[model samples]
Target: MTFADLALGEPVLKALREIGYETPSAIQAATIPPLLAGRDVVGLAQTGTGKTAAFALPIIDRLDLSQKAPQALVLAPTRELALQVCEAFEKYAGHLKNVHVLPVYGGQGYGVQLSALRRGVHIVVGTPGRIIDHLEKGTLDLSELKYLVLDEADEMLKMGFAEDVETILAETPETKQVALFSATMPAAIRRMSKQYLHDPEEITVKGKTQTSANVPQRYLVVQWQQKMDALTRILEVENFDGMIVFGRTRSITEEIAEKLRARGYSAAAINGDVAQPQREKTVNQLKSGKLDILVATDVAARGLDVERISHVVNYDIPTDSESYVHRIGRTGRAGRSGDAISFVTPRERGLVKMIERATRQEMTQMSLPSVDEVNETRLSRFDDRITAALGDSERIDRFRDIVAHYVRNNDVPEVDVAAALAIVAQGDTPLLLEPDAEPEAPRERRERTDRDRGDRPDRGDRPERRAPREGLATYRIAVGKRHRVEPRQIVGALANEGGLRRDDFGAIQIMPAFSLVELPANLSRETLDRLSDTRISGQLIELRPDAGRPQRRTDGERKPYRDDRGPNRPSFRDGGDRKPRYKRGDG
Candidate 1:
């Protein structure tokens, strides 16, 4: 049905028409009516399902323009999403006058947010941490808040903002209408909704498979270390008008964009770190054809509707099926056909199956583009360049005369002269990839036997010792046994944040107040900086290069490495006197 059928206000309808939004999406069609009736709503929908507009339209229609002490407050998980929601509110309220919307997140200056709040903003979109800061400082008055929205509640909790979110919710008036939107309703999110929302109308938008039916999805099984090579090969072979590469983190997006630029591709990145204005400009560049590729994290790429996006490349597989749908939905817009390719590591093969089950469509397995295929694509493009240049007679005549003179003066054959000129045009880099440098074929998938499916024996508290890997250096991180940090937690955080493969890590040793682990010796300054700021179990890692070997503990200082097994469990020393639970003859 049209937005008008949803009974949106005339001004809102005008704005929607101006933006070319004719019909309501499924989430909008289901949730907008209940929201307009001033009831609490629990919306279950993925990221790109027009959720912002679903809530934004109703809020704008019900806004009392005269009252301006933050009638509506939207809490998002990240700065990029906050800005995006704020922009959506502004866009929907364009026809209405004297309505100000402000976005407050950590990175931007508080002075700007304060000024906007002081000048009387009707809507405030912010991350939970900053919102809590404003509320504690008494800078934001939410007593008159008529609407409170917890957007992406699952993501907010995942980012460790649950306490901050509850604090903000408590500050609002109990009678304020609340709407909670999430892609997935985990137990935590469900418990939150029950505690906060009052008899909320639950709406679930399902079957995004239909939305992406026109798009073809494919998967490539590649090692983590070879993702870059696989991506380069795809770019060389795929004919795309505009492409988006999805990375898991902000740093990965920036890294991908930088490498693409260095390879002579017109690319840019948008992430939480990028300011809203710059992100807008980058998106505009992509729309205008000045940029051919956009590398982005999921939050940064929310609500992106670019008609020319012909391909979406998932450089890293998303952790969930919903995210997989949202990432690919960026393309295949406006009834245009699109392609989506995901680089799945061997460990992530199960995720592909999950995605297929969720989408009700099986993804075709794709091999890395062969060297012969790349060379053929390169030659075809080169021929096209020559054909285009032939139309420019003046420049071609000048170059032809120079080549002829060189051939005559050097007594070289005309073909040899042409080959030399071609080489010069191609630069020092090889025009084609070496056949021997091709990536290894994907490993054959094997079914898990009963033995493989069975649980393995536990390895105990501390990991086994091993020799240090070549080109790896021991580094110390500041949270350890005292902080209740575990070895797996450290490995997961470091490996994921640093974009390092599992093989890149050598060994890990947990000490009392610190731990030492081996990582790549030649980590870039940016990667190191990112690792330093990473958090494990709500504590900073503070990663630094270790010096000297760890000293052995004396007899009195030797305590169990971990004390989490409860006081009743026997300690290492106490266990020596206890009888074996299983005697040798018992089995």
Candidate 2:
């Protein structure tokens, strides 16, 4: 049935029409009427099944725009999903004036959320953890919340967010209309519905949640650290019209997108923090062929229906099979054949089996493209490029004359001259992947033994002050122990802001007042400035090149040791009573 049959407001219908959403999915058609009638709904539908629109449309239709204090709240499992739901709300509410939808989640600074809350919001979509944080801080008031939605309810429970979810449900008004959507109805989820939902109208979309058969599923067993390298090789070899690389976290999406762009690929990232207008623009660019690769978190890519997307890459595998189904569904749309590739870490092998069991489809284990394969692909592409350039006979004739002149003056063979010109056209980059530059094999990771029990691991109290890796330089930032900042916070802030990967960092020493981190030595001024402005734990990072100051001991006291011998060896101090000499095995 059409949205009009459900009696939705004109603004929502208009927005839907503009979005080209004419027909409602089964779950939407069933859930919308109950929700509009103010009846609680328990929607059982898989991901990518128009679940967001089912709840979002009615919520927008029922929203009292004059009363701006969060009329509706949606809690999603991840920050990515939270932002995705928030974006959907904004899209559906476009015709409804002054309908502000804000998404709150972890890893984002609170200042933006606090300001938005103070200014008043019509709807708030957020993760359980961040929503709880705001509630505790009294920054978010849900007393006026008329509708409470738990999207991906099963996912929230699987992520161990059930406690936080219950706490949030407790805080909301008892009279609020609740819509609980889940892909699966596990026992725990069923109990939750019984506890939280008031005689919820049960609606289930029957059928096993499976991806399109048109999409050939394949997986690569790769190490967590080598995913980017594997992805680069895949991009080079795969013949794709458009691709979406799904990252598990928002920072990771940005990191992957940045790396792809640096490697000369047309790519961009979209996540919860990206403004709705920018997100829409990015999606439009992907549709219009202006962007080739979209690195996105699951939620950011939710409900993204682009017929041009011929491939989907799971740079980081989803925690659950449902998300995997949703991610791959981005491709194989409109009856087009698509390819789905997932990078599974060795530790996450079980997840693959789980997905196979859930979808009843075996994902072919695919090996990463070897160096030889990548080189072959590159040579093939280079040949095709030359052929395409030959089509431009006018330009080729002008360049050929210049090449002929060079060959005639230098007394070189015409073939040798053509080869030289080819080299010049190829530029400074190597024409092929080096034999030694292959990515680390995932099998090696699986075969690794645990460290010796006798060996002492590095502790925060005694951080090792080792030199940075080759081609890396030490940099210092002003937030540290005093600010209660962890190494991850520093990495997350820098990586998300600067578009660098986790491997880009070397040693990260969190000092009491400041922290020293190792980064690529050749950072551009613009990147450094952007990193410098990044905030960690509410404090500006103030990132800058380390001044090579004499290393300080963690403790207040220090012993005089020979600089050449290193800190492990004892040395004589000038003021000491006697010069103490130490020998091997000396007590």
Candidate 3:
């Protein structure tokens, strides 16, 4: 249906026309009406299904621009997403006067954010961590908040921010309307909806599968170290139009993009650090056939609607199942069949299985490309292009004249001259790549140490320690050894949950009861509120500024508190209340 049929305001309709959007996507058509009716919504739709505009349009139309305080708050899982949401709001509010939209996330300076908050933005789009920080600092006055949105709800859940989300929601005005959107509905998300939402309307749009029945799917189980060589071999052999390579981090995205360019493939990186204008330029280049390959992080590639994408290569398997679906969903779109190749390291096979079960699709196993096969493919392409060129009548006379002149000079044979020309055309580098050795399996009965839990550096010296910022705040999370949590899991969860990059974090120490993490001083109170709702490993993580050491229980027992009435409660010590409490000096 058309935007007019959706009953959007005149200004918003004009904005949509300016962007050349005439009709509403299925998700938008279904969600916009109910949202305008002021009903709580839980929308389930895949990426690239035009979900952003569905919420943005209604939110913008309903916005009271004259009000200075933030009336709407949208929480996203990543900085890129936060920025995208802010951009959408700006676009839809173009015709409105004095409308301000601000995006808060890690990796950006807090001084600037403080100034913006002081200036009083009308709408705030932010990641959970930063939003909570703002709430705690009282910089973000959300008492006037009328609308709250949780975009990519499942992503926040997987990133271990479910607890943080809850905390943020709790701080919001109870009268505020809430909307939650996700691509998949995992158990944790459903539990969250039950706890926070007030009888929300559920909207589910099934994703269209585009795996070609003719194009086979295969994966090579290789070590992470060997992935580069394997990918090079595949590129040499595969006849693909603009392959998309997926990486888990911005650094890896840049690294792979640079390597591909160095190897003579037209490549570019798309990530959070890349400016929006540059990202648009790079994407346009790829669509126009100027760029042959693109390496990107999942957040950077969200809502990317490019039809020329032929192959999606997962340079690194995603940490969670939902990400796998989003990554592969890049290639297969609009009734076009596509190929997705995942590089699965031995340790990551379990993750692959989780993804397979989540997507309900079985991936086929294919052998790695041999050196000979790559060479043959390359030579075949070269021969075909050259043959096509030679078939042009205008070019035949030029080639014949050159051959005649060469044969007349120095008694050179035509065969020898042709061989020389072929050698020159081959270029300097040879297309021979050696396969890497397989990774060793984890030992069956090994001692478990901090290093064994994927905490140690994968490649390099011990991580250098940095002094904590003097004015920075330290927060504690109720996750430690008891929950089988590791430093990387903590780091990944915080980075992904809080929308903080690797650099945004400070010192970290893990204790038996919880882990303490350092964050910037003068962080927003709103950010802190969001952080409290973050969950790690399906458990609510209690986040609060360093309360200067928790008070010890006078009962003198080292065991954790147990409440039998709570859901999923831990069992009490044997003998119940009759159990003796250990004294301080007792062994």
Which candidate achieves the best TM-score against the true structure? Answer: 1
Model 1 earns a TM-score of: 0.72
| TM-score per candidate | 0.72, 0.63, 0.70
Residue 543 lDDT, candidate 3, scale 0-100: 81
Q: After superposition, how far is residue 539 of candidate 3 from its true place, in Å?
A: 13
**Which residue window of length 10 is worst by lDDT in model 3?**
578-587
Runs in model 1 lying further than 4 Å from the true structure: 107-109, 157-167, 185-199, 209-211, 390-437, 442-587
The per-candidate count of clashes, in order, stands at 0, 0, 30
- For model 2 the local lDDT of residue 509 reads 66
How much RMSD separates candidate 3 from the native structure? 10.0
Candidate 1 accuracy as lDDT: 0.80
Residues 265-294, candidate 1: write the lDDT tens digits: 999998766766898899999989999999
User: lDDT per model, in order?
Assistant: 0.80, 0.80, 0.75
The Cα RMSD in angstroms, rounded to one decimal, for candidate 1 relative to the true structure is 9.2
